[model samples]
Every structure is written in structure tokens, then in C-alpha cells.
Target: MKLYHYPLSGHAHRARLFMSLLGIPHELVEVDLKSGAHKTPEFLALNSFGQVPVLDDNGTMISDSNAILVYLATKLGRTDWLPTDAKGAAGVQRWLSVAAGDVAFGPAAARLVTVFGAKFNPEDVIGRAHVLLKRLEAHLADRDWVVGTGPTIADVALYSYLSSAPEGNVDLSAYPRVNALLRRIEALPGFVPFAKTAVGLAAAA
Candidate 1:
């Protein structure tokens, strides 16, 4: 398996992190976003949206981070990471929606502004991040994992941006339960970390 990704992209990081957690042997192909590599015809052939985190498993190509997570879990028969039953599948899909929707517009967008000089309003995105964080804190009150008694694709989908929210100026200090969940994910065997950047340094970038 090969993962094409940009290091600073949270979407890409989630896919990379999950492969690592699964103990899957893979190659990392770093896409140079700064150089317009993703915009080229060759790269866009893999993903029409020209996004990072495209998985090339043998000849099969999968795009979108959450979709990659689903594909890997299902194909590998890691039912522990992705249950096949309707109720359990729906439970995980709910949070994967949050990862694509709320998490994207919230912490991920906020981080883009700081780290990549994107034009989103810092105040607005940061506020949105907090709103999502508060809900996650509540949802995680008595649970270490998001959708089940053990870690699943839902947990993997939410990990990258939530753990890196501080770089977007979204404070984690008030969300102990959320922070605890992050800690538990980090402690798992084969855990891989998202790259970290200082807020000041990211802003200057």
C-alpha cells in the first residue's frame, strides 16, 4: 500500500495514522502542496478533488481519508476496528460524518488559516472548533473511545484534527474528557503521531 499525503494536512494524517495503527506495511509518498504537485494532471488522476491521502493498494486507488479508513478496515477484515452489523456501522458512520463536515470546517479550517495562510476568519473558525470540542467532551464523558467499548474507525477519523486543534488556537484545556480520549489513542500499540508545529511558527508560514 502507498499513501500519497502532505505532512501538514490533517485529512492525510488521519489516513496515515490509521494504516500505522493497523500495523500495515506501506510507503509514504509526500505530495508537495507548496509546489502545485497536487494540481497536476497526474496527481488529479488519483483524486479529482486533488486532495492528499489517496491510498494506492496494489492497483486499486481510494481517495478521501474517511473512505480510506473504511476500505482498509473492511478489506482487512478488522471488524474490531469496523463492525459489520448495521447498528455498529451506523454508530461509526455518524462520527465519520462529523469528521468530514464539522471537523473539516472547524479545527481543520482554523489550522489551514494559521499553517497555510488560508483566508478563513480565525475567530469564526476557532469558535466553531470550540463548539465541536464541547460536544465531543460531553459525548466522551464516560467513554475512552468514540463509538464503542474499543477504538474504531470513528476514533481514527476524529483523532488528527482534534489532537492538533491547539495549533489552530482552539484550546483543549477546558475539555478534559476530550483530552483523555486523545491520550488513550496515543497509548495504543502501533500509534503514529501527526506532525506538530508551533502556533507561532505555523502562523508565520
Candidate 2:
């Protein structure tokens, strides 16, 4: 297996983290996004979208971080990572949607504006981050894991950007439950953390 990724990309980290948690050994091929390597003709053949974190499992390529998590979990037959029952699977799917939707638009986008110099309204994305964090804090109040009894891909899906939310100036201190959840995930075996960028709030400090 080969993972084409960028170190600073949370999307790429999610895929890499899961494989590590499951003890799946693979090769890491860093894509030089700064130099427009992702847009090259060779890269386009792997993913037309020209994004990082494309997984190549023996020539079968999978794009999208969430989709890659699903593929790897299901392929490995790891029910704990992704439930098999309808209700359990649906529960995981809900957060996966949140990861792609609210989490993407909120915390992830906020980080993009600061860390990546993306042209998005800082106030807008910060507001979105707070809103999403409030909801997640409430949801995680009574549950240690996102779904079922053990950690799932949903947790992996949301962990990267949310853990690095401080870089976006979306404070995590207000959400203690969210913080506890992050700490728990960090303590999990084989957990590989996303690389941190000391910008945004860190710079202000």
C-alpha cells in the first residue's frame, strides 16, 4: 500500500493515522503541494480532483479521506473500527457526515485561512468552528467513544482537524469533553498524531 500525502494536511493524516492504528504497514509518498506536484499529469491519473491523501492499495486507488478510512477498515475486516450492524454503521456514518460537512466547513476551514493562507473570512469559519464544537461537546458528554464501545473510523475522521483546531484560533478549552475525547484518542495504541503548525493562536501567544 502507498499513501500519497502532505504532512500538513489533516485529510491525509486521518488516512495515515487509521492505517497505523490497525498496524497496517505501508509506504508514504509525500506530494509536494507547494510546488504544484499534485496538479501534474502523473498525479492526475491517480485522482482527477488533484488532492493529497490518495490511497493506493495494490493499484486500487481510493480518494477522499473519509472514504479511505472506510475502505481500509472494511477491507481489514475490522468491525471495531467500523461496525457491521445497521444501527452501528449508521451511527458511525452520521459523524463521518459531520466530519465532511460541518467539521470541514468549520474547524478545518478556519485552519486553512490561517495555516495555509486560504482566502476565507476568519470570523465566519471561527463561528462555524464554535458551533460545531458545541454540538460535539454535548454529544460526547456521556460517551467515551464516538460510536459503539470502541473507537471507530468516525473518531479518526474527526480527530485530525479538531485536534489541531487551536491552530485555526478555534479554541478547544471551552469544550472540555471534546478535549477529554482527544486525549483518549491520543492514548490509544498505535495512535499517530497529526503534525502541528505553530501559527494562528499560537503566534498570538
Candidate 3:
């Protein structure tokens, strides 16, 4: 397996992190987004959207971070990481939607402004981030993982951006339960970290 990714992209980190947690052996092919590598003809052929984190498993191309996660779990038959039953599957799917929707527009968008100089209203995205965080804090108040008893792809989907939300100036100090959930994910075996930028370091300090 080969993962085409960029270090700073939370979306890319989702695929990379899951592969690590599952102990899958793969190659990391860094796409130089700064130099327009992702938009190149060769790259666009893999994904018309021209995004990082495209997975090539023996020439089978899979794009989108969440899709990659689903493909991996289904292909590997890892029902532990992704439930097979209807209710369990739906539960995980719900959070995956949140990761793509609310989490994307909220915490993930906020970080884009600081980390990549993306043009977005900081106040708006930061507010959205907190809104999502508060909901997550309440949801996690009585549970460690997002979907089920054990950690699933849902947890992995939300981990990258939420853990780095401070970079977006979305302070997480008030959300103890969410912080605890982050800590729990960090302690898991074979866990790989999302690389922090200068903005994130200052926010942490």
C-alpha cells in the first residue's frame, strides 16, 4: 500500500493514523502541495479533486479520507475497528458525517486559517469549532470513544483536527471530557501523532 499525503493536512493524517494503528505496512509518498504537486497531471489522474491522502493498494486507487478508512476496514475484515452490524455501522457512520460536515467546517476550517493562511473569518470558524466541541464534550461525558465501547474509525476521523484545534484559536480548556478522549486516543498502541505547526505550539504554550 502507498499513501500520498501532506504532513500538515488533517484529512491526510486520518488515513495515515488508521494505517499505523492497524499495523499496516505501507509507503508514504509526500505530495509537495506548496509547489503545486497535487494539481499536476500525474496527481490529478489519481484524484480529479487533486487532494492528498490517495491510497494505492496494489494499483487500486481510493480517494477521500473517510472512504479510505472504510475501504481499509472492509478489505481487512477488521470488524473491531469498524462494526459490521446495522446499528453499530450506522453509529459509526453518524460520526463520520460529523467529521466531514460539522468538524470540517468547525475546527478543521479554523485551523486552515492559521496553519495554511486560508481566507476564512476566524471568529466564525472558531465559533463553529466551539459549538461542535461543546456537543462532543457532552456526548463524551459518559463514553470514552465516539461510537462504541472501543475505539473505531469514528474516533480516528475526529482526532486529527480536534487535537489540533488550539492552532485555530479554539481554546479547548473548558472541555474536559473532550480532552480526556483525546488523551485516550493518544495512549492507544501504534498511535501516530499529527505534526504540529508553529501556530499550534504557541497555542499549546
lDDT of 2 by residue, 1-205 (tens): 9999999999999999999999999999999999999999999999999998999999899999999999998998989899999999999999999999999999999999988899999999999999999998889878998898789999999999999998999988889999998999999999998998888886665
Ranking by lDDT: 3, 2, 1
What would the per-residue lDDT of candidate 1 be over residues 97-176, giving only the tens digit for each residue? 99999999999998888788999999999999999999998998888889879999999899999888888878788999
Worst 10 residues of 2 by lDDT: 196-205
Off by over 4 Å in 1: 200-205
TM-score of each: 0.96, 0.98, 0.98
What does the lDDT read for residue 70 in candidate 3? 99
Candidate 3 lDDT (Cα, 0 to 1): 0.94
Q: Please report, in order, the local distance difference test score of every candidate based on alpha carbons.
A: 0.92, 0.93, 0.94
Off by over 4 Å in 3: 200-204
Pairs in clash, predicted candidate 1: none
Candidate 2 segments whose C-alpha is farther than 4 A from its true place? none
Q: lDDT of candidate 1 vs native?
A: 0.92
The collision pairs in model 3 are none
